[model samples]
Target: MEYGNPDFVKYAEAYGAFGHRVESAEGLAPLLEHGIKTPGVHVIDCPVDYSENDRILNQAFLRAFGSRRQAMQKVLFKPATGHGPDA
Candidate 1:
């Protein structure tokens, strides 16, 4: 595992780029607001934890669908009773 800034902020500095480091969700709003308020190109360094990716994605999907989990499941996966495309 290489140890360094994954967002490569140093490179941005070398190129005179505008950026903000977002260490947590709390920093996101300010960064977003800054991007919206400012006119120049901006970079937001927001690293995410991929370990809980499944749970995070599932929760997001559930929230978006709003209690249509079963319907989403049917659309995402076919029946295993050998009555679909595989059959």
Candidate 2:
């Protein structure tokens, strides 16, 4: 699951890091189990689809802030005007 970027497995291997390259969600459990059961450091290279991630994040954002007028009354979050109470 190496973020679909340049392979970094060599670095891990050089340091004796043990892990798995998970291309999908299904590979998570087994890799996690192996890491927990075995000793020493482990790593999981999980790549993600940027486009799909963007879409999902956008949808979640809309759902959370859909009712702007109502939400604004209770909380000081305003994405539209970008003005809110000091943190």
* Per-model CA lDDT versus the true structure: 0.74, 0.72
Best model number under TM-score? 2
Q: Which residue pairs in candidate 2 collide?
A: 1-21, 1-22, 1-45, 1-46, 1-47, 3-47
For model 1, which pairs clash? none
Give the lowest summed-lDDT range of ten residues in model 2: 78-87
Per-residue lDDT of model 2, residues 7-67, tens digit only? 6555677788874678889888988898899998887788776878867865765688786
Q: How accurate is candidate 1 locally (lDDT)?
A: 0.74
Best by lDDT: 1
User: Over the stretch 1-87, how does candidate 1's per-residue lDDT look in tens digits?
Assistant: 878556655556667777677899987998899889988767777777787988887787777766556648765775568677778
Query: Where in model 1 is the C-alpha error above 4 Å?
Result: 1-5, 54-87
